[model samples]
Target: MMGKTWIAAAICAAAIFSVFPESRAQQAPASPSVDAPELAALGSYGIGVADLEFIDKGRADPLQGADVPRVADRHISVKLWYPAAAKGGGTRYRTGLPGETGSDVPFEVPGLATPGAAMAKGRFPLVILAHGYSNTPEVLSWLGENLASKGYVVLAPAFRDPPITIRTPAARAGPLTSRPLDIAFVAAEAQRRAKAGEGLLAAADGARTALIGYSMGGYGVLTAAGAPLDPGLGGATRGVLAPFVAGGPKADTLKVADVKAVVAISPASNLYGTPLWAAPGVAAIRAPTLFIVGSQDHVVGYETGVRRLFDQEVHAPRYLLTFREAAHSIALIGAPPAMRESFWDFDWFEDAVWRKDRLMAVQAHFITAFLDRNVKGEAAKSSYLDGLVPNSNDGKWPNAPTGRYAGFSPGAPASTIWKGFQPSRVSGMNFEFRPGEP
Candidate 1:
């Protein structure tokens, strides 16, 4: 719960259960080669999806309002996955989730829904996800529907604002106002869809909604926390909000108060050059939070911004965990690369690329633990939050930070290792990753 209106509604919704559902999909095909629960347990040691299909972007450029430019009003897409009513039989393919109507790519999925089948329905907990900046909704394939397989309803929307074609001096000058609100809007709509029964994952309890974001989407979570954002510095970080301000500004406010809790991994905030959780806009978030990052991160370094956010927030219960061998995007699990590349130092603030579904399993487990404890009245299981991350065999299978990959060799005794996220005292069968060419 983050937006003011939504927070109020969420508060009222606490007692009202508005679970949505799409008509049951056609029959499922074959049972997945491996049951999903076993797949999830692998996160205990940081492995990834063995064989999963890609759910591509279904559509693009949705809302076309007067104030919104065509470029600004870009596409929205998402994929819906779950333990089908029956196992699937068709071949499995992998693709990004796109909006229901824009640009897209289609492939085989076991007993997958064909375009007009009902959206989906179930009585599952609703999890609305926000992707990082300049990324389509497909970026975090690591987490989404896989979590759905674990009995949760996952909703991921493409909220890339100002769509980076604004590379020119003139276009770059436009104000970036909608991104945060876009997240808020998407969350609200997900609830509406569930309440109205047009949603993908039908088993949704509107009262049990939670927010999960990465990178810029992380900033959107902060903004939704009912905090206020200050004017930031120039260059890649400035975004669309800078140039639109007029005399004394039109009140640059950001916050979302309805979220019961949030899990932000490798979010970007604070001044690039300076350190500290500079995005005070999210400071007003009084809900519980689970913040994950990498000690060895070079992309959004482990210094000022994200660190300060955790250090200063006093109202809500918050925790931060830094993966030893990981970087900004390494914390999740997804598709293994045909070949590995170390572009950790690539100028992402200025460029863009597709991050595979490497961290989904771990992302799903940690996030599930957070939601269970915070939104579902259960307890969280995190040793790092308790300052107990083991020094030896942690079951975390996170990717090393791009710049930090020493290229020594896989299993070469480097200073870092992970297995299913239990960073200390674990074994190999429970994990996957080779830091160097052993």
Candidate 2:
């Protein structure tokens, strides 16, 4: 079988134009720049980044081939993005994106943040990012960089995944068991190193922390943040798929305490027939959360996946943001130059029902509001979260000017504008909230 990157690129591209051409073409903005719109719209800080590696001695090397000697430990690589002083020259970094075999699509993406730049004054809250299966940290850099600029330290880790041509179920067994464990491990590691003033980690506040995850990552954060797992899950009898089941010998170690908030995008809650997290299981989550998913997500079923997960989290104050007919890629980093080689590759970043830039900008606004309110204790940010309108387009006045709408403008009444959004810029989205049970 082909790599997941290639398979997804091919399958989604055919599905995009055929299923939603009108919607996509209509929403396409006049000129979308290669740069992420939301990344440039926030705070004043320059970004500094560095890479850190950690060894996990408790976990076995799941990837060790039968013929090779068994390895006792697993190593993790993390890329840290933080607020930085602007006195020094910025350095370029590399990234990986999906590409066709023997093609010119480059493996390395040029970085926007400088490497080894001086750390900005004052410690900031920390946000850890975990990406979808077979994806790299660069794929989610849009969020990491933007959050760092907004006075938060962001760390994105590349999870272990099967390489191309090795898509068998056995290849996923190791990563499944290790994904959530990896997240919890990194959270503790980031704080430990930061408090010790280690490398770029010196910029982390560590007092407040949050988790942002997409796809498989959504599963990792949810598990790490205290979602209960089935005691019989992850049993060894299941063979290649056993490592993914919950509640095996390693289940007790997957959780982390004190996560302030969580944002899960298109969470993979039901990858298998049974829900990875049952209602009773998810009810254990204590952190306030924001769940974002497209109503039409094909990869992870909307009703069965994210929405189901959101509904089960009754113990936490939660909000659900639904992109009308958008798909699973609602919040990925912008498409890199390499992905443009084919429509399929481009579909890896573009959503069928929403423009990528617009989707990313909207995500930035809400994410900032959420992190500020929950992680930074900015009480004023509550205005953005409370009393949200169900539909972005419904808040406009009947006779309002063609482009004049409500919800974010100072002059627009609360009834007309979406509480935290600027008028004329918000459309085709829905937001719902459920307060935690006292």
Top model number, lDDT: 2
- My TM-score estimates for the predictions, one after another, are 0.58, 0.82
Model 2 C-alpha lDDT per residue in residues 326-350, reported as the tens digit of each score:
9988767556655766887777778
Pairs that collide in candidate 2 are: 91-114, 95-109, 233-246, 234-245, 234-246, 406-417, 407-417, 407-418, 408-421
lDDT of every predicted structure (CA atoms) = 0.45, 0.71
Q: What is the lDDT of residue 61 in candidate 2?
A: 50
Which structure among the candidates has the greatest TM-score? 2
